[model samples]
Target chain A: MFDSKQFEKDAAEIMARYDQKKAATLPLLHLVQEKIGYIPPEGEQWVSEKVGVAIVHIREVVSFYTMFRTKAIGKHHIQVCTNLPCVLRGAEQVMAYLKERLGIDAGQTTPDGKFTLSSVECLCACEIAPMCQVNDRYIGPLDRAAVDKLLQDCV
Target chain B: MASEMVLSKRLKNPGGAWFDAYVADGGYAAAKKVLTAMTPAQVIDEINKANLRGLGGAGFPTGKKWSFIPKDSPKPKYLVVNADEGEPGTFKDRYLLERDPHALIEGMLIAAYSIGCHKAYVYIRGEYIEPYRRFVRAIEEARKKGWIGEAVQGKWDWEVTVHRGAGAYICGEETALLSSLEGGKGFPRLKPPFPAISGLFASPTIVNNVETLCCVPPIIRNGAEWFAKIGTPKQGGTRLFSLSGHVEKPGLYEAPVSVTLRQLIEQQGGGVRGGKKLKAVVPGGISAKILTAAEIDVAMDFDSLTAAGTMAGSAGVIVMDESTCMVKALLTAAKFFAHESCGQCSPCREGPGRLYKIIQRVAAGQGRRQDLDVLLAVAGNMEGKTICVFADAAAWPIQSYIRKFRSEFEHHVETGTCELGHAYAHH
Candidate 1:
């Protein structure tokens, strides 16, 4: 089911950026995950072949970085920052609100598979404290009203 | 009071990153001047005269770091920009990367020319999607304008590649960054075969901070004397302090290094939020020792803070008012260190986890009397043992918080609850 022929074209471009082909391991894995939504065993083997590292080594790389996922997440992944700054600005309340509304704790996906909630460290957006990253965008200074709107907007 | 805005001058007016607008503001002039008129040694000397230190927490001298690269090393040299800015209370690099990325490119060109590095790599954090896009766009514009790529300004040859870090705070360390750049885990390698000697595939490498490089263009345009005059004698130019937490106005403010912490909290941050009395302040990032309200009169420079028994780390002044709880704050910080430790050394790998567990017990109203002593003893052992300074950084919050606010921890342990009211409930 995996598209090896199509993936190679993009994989070659990423490998071309680095002097050593092994340096493209992360980027190639990222590309595979971006297209497939998670790093499956096949995707890992493909990346291992492309970057010239063993599949076990590629799995080690995948497990080390927190961003790469082994399993697929929900349609919308929400990562709430519980670092000191956000905690000072009431990130706990935001997390609690999401938990109550969605009926799931941190690192859990919704039954409908519409949302995934995670509690993460600093995203380096402290100026907008009490913030969360939904997919790619950062929504911050979160309050009760904002949470209501965010859940609605997830659709 | 507004000091000389050296790094943030262009950020004042919006849309400053447009290629034509950046060119109109005399951008890339420094790169042109360095490539055409100045020798590599001259460029290094000029930076030395400027007295600029790295803005990414360590405060190491920039020119001295660049000078470490061997000119006669047959292997190609590399210039790696550390844009993996993930200090808990810091977010200034995101602004520079998004608002005026041309400054960083120009800085890189001059830096590459000075060190004879034909290739440069920028390691940006993956969470910073917007900042990364804006920076990549700026690089594309420069490539079209002949500021980057095979022939920079049609004089020297330089190429820049932007590498995105997956998600690890440890990658902010230079050695760890090189490891991640080489497509491995972000474990920091032992130094002495320092990056300047053997780095990025066994070649000489120079790793500079995002803000440190951004300061280079101004130092090149105006003479080193002019740049050095903007701040204290030891540290040149202004710093974009990332002011956040319990402040009425939590935002980035550019001020001279000579500026005291009080001025940043009062004048720039509009004092503590809701006119509450100031309590304790983390003068730098979470790792720096916390400063009480009385101790904030000291200058916010590297040396001054060092004399005051703290560090001017990352220039992230996190203001805390009287309402803030010290025990809760320490727990949050400890949690960060525990979560981000790369598990390389035995001390750093084990120490932060233990600290967080003990603190968690205290915060949840089940702490024993010997918890404080155990915490201090554990923290003391963690320092000076790790390959990197991460364990020491982790130990600081545990040491400083309990030392400065000993009574608070004692009250929590003895009474099994916070005396200052629940931190999360009211918030």
Candidate 2:
């Protein structure tokens, strides 16, 4: 199922950028995720086959960073930032509001799998203290009212 | 000047790291241009010509840092991406990594190729697990497509690894990152040997900020001349400022460093909450000295910020509107640094806690005039005396708050209670 020519082409380009294959952690991850919707549970082994490194090396990387999601999620992943700034600005209330409205706890997907909820740290829009990530896009300074409005708008 | 490109970069079909989506949006075209067209020296020279510096506090020239690696070094050279977005009041990296990890990856590939590194590491904060996972997953996709393995592009051998730090602020420092990569305590080391010349596993390394490296893909693709044209003199390119606090629409903004706080606040942030007037701003995070409402006209650049008596550290613009009690707000700020202190250095470990205690005393309606002087003395003594900037970071708000908001502080002491309403009384 894997296209070796395309693999060689992409690998050549990635190799041209760095001096060693191990340094391609984020790049390799990005390439894999972009190819597959999410990093396959066997991503480390898959990458090991692609990049020619020990699977453990890739495993250590997958285990270390939060950016790499091992589990499957709904079509849209929503993250609520409840860091100190957001918390100070009512991020907890926003999270709770989303929970009550969406009817799912953190890290749980909706029945239709259209949405998944998780608690993110912060999304830089601290001025709008409470923020969230709907997939890749940032939603912020979230209040209970704003969360309701955003949810309605998203649907 | 070019706009803040990172924040404004297209957030579109990332295509799961497939070559088509990346290529469709003009991805490796830049790397191909660099590898076949421009020599490594020429690429570095192009960056030097642009006059870009490290956006991460230190104004080190971008090209100079890259050039620190020897031309013919035998050992593995590395280009490490500093994705450890740990600085309080700073969260731009998370936004970039979350929304556009591909751009950073593209940039990393270009930087590694240009710097003669066949390997790269995106050293991220462990707490940022989700963001880190997305980034790593993206890289995996790149690897499966043969973009990260041996004979990449049919000739170059390169690899990228993601090293995650275990929730330590000091790990943001380059040496600490190297130590964490080596499975050691995340304490900073003296810098006779910088990371560029001697880094990770004693090999030459180029540890660039996530935002900084992310800028490279665009620069290389668009040309250094184009990047140079953006921002202001000496400060090339845009900055991603994380505007927080009591603003109407607080969020991230990517604008030229020339943009004033007022523009970022009034125009982008939708003004203060409930149309409240501005009080002061902790420009560039807690480490930066407080900027009074009167001093909000300063440009958000390295040189301009320094002249205005503050540093553009991480571009974390924490706006403080009126209704904020300077004493209590500062006490909160001091407490964060105190708690986050690594305790590796006494200046930070002991000083921030003591500063918090003093600020608490002042906030709790019990203070002395000498206490003000003691706060200044504490901050002054801590400066340039620690292994890392943590002590100085802990002390800056204390010293700067007292200097800029002396009247408010004196009012707290005079009234034996904060004059501001309940909002200021507690967090």
Candidate 2 C-alpha lDDT tens digits along B1-427 = 3344643555433343444566677776776777677788888888887667786666678888998888777888888888877766787887777667777777777778778888777788756667877787778877887767788776568877776565556678778777656544566777868887789878998989988877777788777887777867687788887877777776777888788988888887788778888888877876788898899888888889899989888888777778777887687677667656767787877888888788888888888878888988988888889887778787788888898889988987777876775333332
lDDT tens readout by residue for model 1, B1-427: 3447787778877688778888899988898999888999999999999999999989999999999999788999999999999888999999999999999999999999999999999999988989999999999999888888776656788888888999999999999999999999999999989999999998999999999999999899988998899878899988899998999999899999999999999999999999999999998898999999999899998999999999999999888889888989998899989999999999899999999999988988889999999999999999999888889999998999999999999999999989888743311
**Could you list the iRMS of every candidate?**
2.1, 6.1
- Best-fitting candidate, measured by DockQ? 1
**TM-score between candidate 1 and the true structure:** 0.98
CA shift of B306, model 2, Å: 0.9
Write down the DockQ of candidate 2: 0.14
Give the per-residue lDDT digits (tens) of candidate 2, residues A57-111: 6766555445566666787788876554665566667878888898999979999
lDDT of 1 at A137: 95
Computed on alpha carbons, the lDDT of every model, listed in order, comes to 0.91, 0.74
DockQ, all candidates in order: 0.66, 0.14
Error of 1 at B235 (Å): 0.6
* TM-score of each candidate structure, all chains considered together: 0.98, 0.77
